[model samples]
Target chain A: MLFLRDFGPTEVGGFGISSANDLLLVEDIELVHQACSAVHVTFHDESVADYFDRQVDAGHTPAQCGRIWLHTHPGNCPLPSSTDEDTFARVFGKTDWALMFILARDGATYARIRANTGPGVQQELSVVVDYRAPFAASSESDWEKEYLANVHDAALNTKDTTVKDRDKSRSDRFDEWDESDFCDPLLQTQLRGY
Target chain B: MKVLVINNDGGGFADYMDVEPNTTVATLFGQVTKSSRAEDYLIRVNRQPCAADQILQDGDRISFTPTKIEGAAS
Candidate 1:
């Protein structure tokens, strides 16, 4: 089942909303389950970019592939902020079929679904999860299961070479910096959603 | 030691405060929520779901956020 929440009017450019369902369902149910169990979530720039490129290559119109993005926040508030808006514009600007979801520690979450309505203008629909339910167990033929297993195994093994290299550089830099130069900034702003 | 207090409802900014060691999440909540109702916000430690009674550690990231916010398309 899919869930959505309606934002009355505080959202800029349109109503802001969020969702918690799997995005692969927009493609195929079997694929969705395969993705959940077989695919591991990883953060690598090229991996993410290739994932998007593959969607387009798979013949999904820019609007039908429907991308889902998730991030965690420290607090419970589920509202998106100006920074979120800027980030969303940069990330999803090219895709009319993207959905953004923000998960917060407070069990609060938000999502917004975007689709093209016409040329130069688009519509964003909001949805929120009322409650989280257990994902159903799936059964697949031996061959299908094996295929998914292989795909996921390979994806997981894909190395995050960039992150490792960057971390190494940062570590070396930290060793050279004066400890007193690192002062924590005062946080006076409220957490905002994206 | 100084810790960051971020409230999502007011803005997506972080603030630093000097806090004592071994402070419980509940204790910090008390300090922050003194002017507001406790029920109005949700708090998390280190980006994970945490309970009020949970103990806080040094360098832990604490975020306070509302349960939900709705806005119409502008």
Candidate 2:
């Protein structure tokens, strides 16, 4: 589970790791560091291409590298609109494998995976939780406690506390902690008609 | 004078080439790629985008970044 420092809009690029045992670990998030307007996130393909180069330089094979991409949504909608699919297909369709993760404002998560083929295969995945052991207090945030408390039938009426409180707490967080890794797992509990 | 050329397309490599003085970026692009294909790329001089007609400066880091990035807002 990740939390944003400020609820300000951003488009981050990252990848996920998955195994045959239904285990997923989303890692290596790269935020767009370029300057752009608030409504748009401008990035060059070379940046991602450079990322792949550096990953290989670090001895990670291409297969071990993440091909999936992640970004955030201003709304709590967990469904992928046609634009998302189209973009995914256009950019990552020919790749060996890829996935897209959308983190919503209310913290809901929507994930889809594509297989390695000529055009690729598309499938929606259910974000699930089977309960892991208690994490260290330093490793997790108090937000999880608040999230679990309001997990049932969570609703938003234009005044969301999750993102607001996060912005307030950003200064208190460790400087090294990435504020963009903002998906709380409890968000799945809020999924409607998954 | 020498200029750095980094092509974003396949077979791209960061290489330097000798050129005559006052050579414009457009002329250099034509000399290196042998085509006007720079039109498909977003050309930048020293990390700042420049017009093709802008004169090149010695030791400037020019990069040709492909414009075909695919993504969408949710």
Candidate 3:
């Protein structure tokens, strides 16, 4: 909650990690390197792939590591935006099941699960926080490190720009730049979703 | 032949399904996922990544999981 609140008006994205014994029980939140604005977050694809491999190496399945997509909504409305819906459809459409969850700044939240097996079915889910379960003590320092490492806020200096304008600017910048500026050459090939 | 199919896509579930003899992983994937491309998923047999043409055994375990997911805000 504190991590979600720390970003204030900018959005943050993470994955809900659950155990094999209980898929619906989100035991942890895992954040990867991403470039985020107030309305969209583009995860570094290689980082996500690496995270997936790590989870598999640790004996966790991909479903346990990546099924639940969680993000924060800077506005009061927690409803899925067109971009959110489009992303959900494109990325998770083939999965047997997937979950999308959003938490708004005003404490409002929205959650839904989509099942694609047999006949496709989607149902809204209620958000619940189980306080009775044992959890690790809040590590502000660790969170700070994670947040610093993963979240590159595109809104930091572009606060005056509208979301659309920021997006356009980013696209324009990309068009003019070359892959040499990127830290990894693979990033050039993996920049598909934003 | 009955094989354990564990689809790790959305609601990851493990279930037993009867397959015809000599069914390949590619054939089973096409049957279950219908329109999904084989390249978009990681198909494994008995916990190891297998070739699409690999034939399933009577008690083999199979799983399919997507390789990419993108999360966005409104």
Candidate 4:
């Protein structure tokens, strides 16, 4: 079961997560290479490249291949766009499974879970806020209230129907592939599909 | 020299270690596989494909992502 929570303070970013069995927790959000407009958010692969390196250095494994894509909707509709689905399909789809979490300024929320285990698999589930078992954190403080008060209201009247993709070779040094030397002997055979 | 190492094997393992100044990627990888010859790992340095003989830098970031499937949770 894919699960997540509200990230009210995030402007627009992404993160690699650490999960405990069925539960998902934000190890930390990587606030890098974010191209944010009222309609959508785009994350440059560089934004997450080092974060992944750091995450692995800390002893985390890929078995927690689970991911949570956090973004906000500019309008009242909290559903994902076709491009969003495609993004999930191409990037996160490589993993066995992952989740996407969407938030709207109007308080509308949406979520989708995708898996590549056996066949075509993807679904949009209800974003039920569990006020009963509230998040273990401090309540909104006065400064937080003032900050939230000044936030723009549903800034996007229209949604972006276009697709925003990251750079081609995230593994590129300085954003360029090193094809000059013998990088790997089995490179061609292994990366045939990718 | 110091290099950052990341492996997305099971859960995953990221760490920093010292290596010879001119150590090649394959040489370092050889150390990582415990001297066993496993070739299915996707090796990248600073987000770029590196040759087996690619020399190490003082602060290069290296990562290894296994091609094996993680399947579903139990």
Candidate 5:
């Protein structure tokens, strides 16, 4: 009964998550740990990076596509930090139709589910209601398909402008870094998509 | 259901065995902290945020985490 919303990073990776039908979706423990391991250090495998890219590309239409990003705190802190906020602001500033999820080692997770409305001036992130509730079952309903189509088209239409602008800025920032410093090797591969 | 309580601060740990369903989150906190305050720790159910008054169900995964960490946003 896990329904996942998919989104792409145009230049980065794809992200999304399972939604609760009546409560919160408890992610598979092993999957959380795996995601944590992938993001813990600097670089991730190129294949993983490509997987995300393909998701984003596929979600180019605008029906009701969802994007999910996964990360973990080394210890047990689950609250987002200044850096996390900054990154989210930069990455989601343009599209503003994505969601974010954070998993902590101590089994604490947080979700920011975006609300689509208005001229995209305001965004709302809701905390999961019940962590133990089963996720909503996926449906191939016409409404669902139509919603997905809208999101896909919206993504494609703004592909050049929004995503390109963000990626360019991200690359500029990357160029300022010192390659020799102790960088997380995983990050190198993850950044390849961007 | 048995729920494991792990507090990240100073390695504080506790366990609630055979907890009944329909237990309020606030009541669970009271059970976890017998004497001190429960307001200090940030409680999460299976990783998502929840209010103290929210009800707990079967097979719930709960953890008590701290407010701060080194090299993390405070």
Candidate 6:
């Protein structure tokens, strides 16, 4: 999934699925359908609900499927953008724990985990690829198909890649961020026509 | 009555606590989340969605998790 960012002009995202016993050990990175731009990505609301349903059907708890959110940046900065920060605060704030992981095209990375049980705690985490763990064989074709199905790149007209425009665009182009429908699991169920 | 409180907000923790008899989920939610709105969270009892007025029982497990989380770039 990390390699797919190189194939497009937009950012990509996926959930890091882990077992209940080892919540930090990502067993799989599951990509869902989303719209993407050079600097923005939003998962389809129904897609997220469906993903949770599928995970539950497979015997994984919702916490296991939902705690770790992983994404890629098309630029060199792996630091959380203002929008990313807001998203993390508003969305993951209430979870018992949630992790945000970012990978930039230049190979820089960022990760943070937050726990909310008592006094809230937030900590930065180091990223490493653990190759020693036994892994399943990967199929390039399947990954390509997954990428093609999920990542719909909307052309970004602006040439400015600086932090100024990124901050400015948060208010101008991100009206959707204000809406709870896209992020609310209850609304997600309603949107799925359940 | 002792109940398991699995707060999934900041610094997520699960612990057993004593509550007054007949304490409703709404009452416990108010105590746990403080100023936060209940509508913003998915409150559960024994792993199922619960009504705010549902009375707490001894050994009941309660959890409060945010129902919405967004990912964005700016």
Q: Score the docking of each candidate (DockQ).
A: 0.01, 0.16, 0.33, 0.08, 0.03, 0.23
Best by DockQ: 3
Ranking 1 against 5 by lDDT, winner: 1
Q: Residue by residue across A2-45, what tens digits does model 5's lDDT show?
A: 11122221111223333323112423211110111112311122
Compute the lDDT of residue A176 as modeled in candidate 2.
30
Candidate 5 residues lying further than 4 Å off, grouped into runs, are A1-14, A17-49, A56-66, A114-194, B1-74
The segments of candidate 6 whose C-alpha lies over 4 angstroms from its true place after superposition are: A155-194, B1-70
Instruction: Flag the better candidate by DockQ, 2 or 4.
Output: 2
Error of 1 at B11 (Å): 34
* Candidate with the greatest TM-score versus the true structure: 3
Tens-digit per-residue lDDT, B4-45, candidate 3 = 776655544457899999999999998776645776666777
What is the per-residue lDDT of model 4 for residues A30-96, given as tens digits with 9 covering 90 to 100? 3333434455555544334554655555655554433666666656666777756666655566456
TM-score of each: 0.31, 0.46, 0.63, 0.51, 0.31, 0.62
lDDT of 5 by residue, B1-74 (tens): 67654332221233445677788877877766442545444577765667988888776766554321111222
Cα lDDT, all candidates? 0.41, 0.52, 0.72, 0.53, 0.41, 0.73
For each of the candidates, the C-alpha root-mean-square deviation to the true structure, in angstroms, is 24.6, 13.0, 11.0, 17.6, 20.5, 13.9
Q: Which ten-residue region of model 6 chain A has the weakest summed lDDT?
A: A156-165
Better of 3 and 6 by TM-score: 3
Residue A5 lDDT, candidate 1, scale 0-100: 14
lDDT of 3 at B51: 98
Q: Which stretches of candidate 2 lie over 4 Å from their true place?
A: A4-7, A16-24, A32-39, A116-120, A128-194, B1-67
Worst 10 residues of 2 chain B by lDDT: B6-15
Fnat across every predicted model, in order = 0.01, 0.16, 0.38, 0.13, 0.05, 0.33
Stretches off by above 4 angstroms in model 4 are A1-11, A16-18, A25-30, A63-66, A129-194, B1-61, B64-74
